[model samples]
Target: MTASTSTVARTATPRGSILKQRVRWGLDHALPRTVMSYAARKGDLPGRLIVESGNVETADLVDLFDAARADGPLHRGRFSFTTASQVTVKEILTSPDFRTGIVRAGGPLAGLREWADIDILGPLSAPSLLVTEPPDHTRYRKLVTRVFTVRAVEQLRGRTEQIANDLLDKLDPSSPVDLVENYCARLPLTVITEILGVEASDQERVLTFGTAAAPSLDLGLSWHTFVGVEAALQDFDAWLTDHMDHLRAHPGDNLMSKLVAATEDGVGLNDAELKATAGLVLAAGFETTVNLLGNAIALFDKHPDQLARLRAEPGLWSNAVDEVLRIDPPVLLTGRMAVRDTTVAGMRVPEGAIVSTLLAGANRDPEVFTDPNAFDVARPNAAEHMSFSAGRHYCLGASLARMEGEVGLRVLYDRFPGLALQPGAERRPTRILRGYDKLPARLS
Candidate 1:
């Protein structure tokens, strides 16, 4: 067997390990929610936000965020601090004083990491780029970041446009359709899977796994959601193992194939590291873009004036994409740990404090944008939004997502200019990853 296969083989989940994973998930759900809920009872904003992150009425989040902003960006709670100020959010994200991946450096759950790692490949896990800090993250990123660069994503733009056109061709403008399923999901799925060298047949399985596992990024998951997500993640990990094996044997021109031979200096990523990197790239590449497309369509349907501006002058399409991201970002929030005691937004944060930065709230901060709550496609500073996040942990797929959003939305409206959003649009229940799961639209 090859080195890649051998490395992957050793990481397989033992049946005993699966049960341990279940216990970890349960502890994860129970402990935090218990603490957060107790704090919420005493009117702690940070705790309230955690407890209600998955609320269907997202306006509650908006209200809580507004309160946070009014509370001056950093609200110290029983366990953590919450911030909705753009300045503080940027400082926390950009500063080396903060880190991701740990539950808390010196908190109660720090030991859980070494105890319960049991072969689960979560985005928040050590090997994945979302949580890993420098040196390691820098290494993984240096090798994998090339394919998603602006130039590289620009290379894919024409192909994405063609894909958009092809997807549009299948839609009939005379009747109602669910754009989320028919267009929003398929466009990115096709593009990213092809980029990763995944066959067309496995795209749906990728989608199923992505849908089931998207919640892995959210905090305080219930037992049912946690188990289901972990199970789906396992299946995805298995598929990735076989896919990596195939790529090693018959390397193609795609990114996955490049990663198969990827190295820095003389050392290459091991199988577990490779699998973690590829898995995140594949899942995150399409999942968030699906949300971006759906969010843009829903936003455009709600604001015809902005959509009309794009219709009259197509130059605004690129900015329009950023505008959509600004107003209704696909991701709602992210958290960071203070590596050492630090001051943020004129407030004190002790070491190990979990700082919850509300990206949606920061995007709408009045201190940053005039009439921040309004949706304006031509807003000059729309590109400043933290929708792709900020600093070293900034989104890897931002360029691709932007390109896909512009091409996909423009292609749809260009194909059927009079498209109208129907009622009953449903938001995906996952908190961290926000977007519509179903958006019914009339093509005529």
Candidate 2:
């Protein structure tokens, strides 16, 4: 077998491992709702959350977040400290002392490195912009920013619209379809691949690997998932290493080629750093956009009147995109560690304390957003949501993701004026990423 095929073959998850994941998924649902409800009202939330681990639905999560926010901007708990207030989350995210890496020296989760066996994962464990401190993050991000400049992303608009229209054309309007698979999943996967210069045939494998690797970002991962995630990362690193070499010899007008040539302060990234950076962009860009598109469609289905408003005013697509992002952020929560002792929103956070920023909760802060739970497409200032996060780590793909979402939603509704959700829409069984696994829809 060829090298790429061998990599794919070795990394495939076993049937038994898949079965284990399914059983664990069932247990997540079987956990009592009353326990979580009662805890939100009367008990120790963070302590109880050590068990639930933010596994509850989005609506249910708001209640817990509200309760947490009521206490203070920063609440120290048994399992983790959390910042539910927008002001506090922004402060922590922007603080020069805090870093994203879990294994940082003297950080709260530093010990987890050995326990999690992160070292064995090779490039998977390499610190990319997502999980590195300044100097390194600043340097790496500067190179990436040059490639994703505003003009560059804007140039992608015509092609993105074309891709959206072409995907829509493939759908049979008269029949029901799983919008997640047939529409939402395809768009970002194709877009990121085309941007990364992956061959058409290899794009499918990239997508498959990305699906497994995405979960590596989760706070809690099962052993089965761990094996699958590491294997996928290994495969991706091998492919990326080869691709970087090829890009060096024969430059193409693509992001990878630009990255290959990018230099800063008379320095450029080596092969390992290149793979990690590319992997970070691909994995983060793919699933987050997938969820973002899925959330917009699913929310529109539930709020028909708002959908009608959007249909009447296609210009409000940007507002609709922001509203959906506020209501159902693809990335639910992120964590940061103090480089030293710090104060957040008047709360004392000592050195090594890990502060979990509840992004979705911050988006729904009543102080910031009036009627925070309601989905109003026409709501003014919807762009104020903290879903894309803030400070230096703000999503690099935020603009690209937004454009794709706007175009994807607009094209779908324009094609099927009466698009409506079928009865059996299913949310993915993930706590960190909130999105539908299968949004059955009728496009009549």
Top of the candidates by TM-score: 1
Q: Please, what are the lDDT tens digits per residue for candidate 2 over residues 19-117?
A: 544433222222323344444455666534434544455776777788778888888775458877898889888999787754334334334332333
* Prediction RMSDs, each to the true structure: 4.5, 6.5
Q: How many Å off is the CA of 284 in candidate 1?
A: 1.5
Q: Model 1, 1-444: lDDT tens per residue?
A: 101100011122433476666656655566777888899899898888867777454444778888888856787777888888898899999999898654333345445543664333234222577766787788878877754568878889899999999988898878789999999999999998988889989999999988887777776778887778767777887888898898888999886787778778977777877788778787778778998998888878878998899989999999999988888888888888787888887788888677888898889888899998788999989999988889998988888888889898888888888899999899888777888899998998
**Worst window of 10 by summed lDDT in candidate 2:** 1-10
Provide the overall lDDT of each model, using Cα atoms, as 2-decimal numbers. 0.78, 0.74
Candidate 1 structure, TM-score to reference: 0.91
Assess candidate 2 and give its lDDT: 0.74
Identify the leading candidate in terms of lDDT: 1
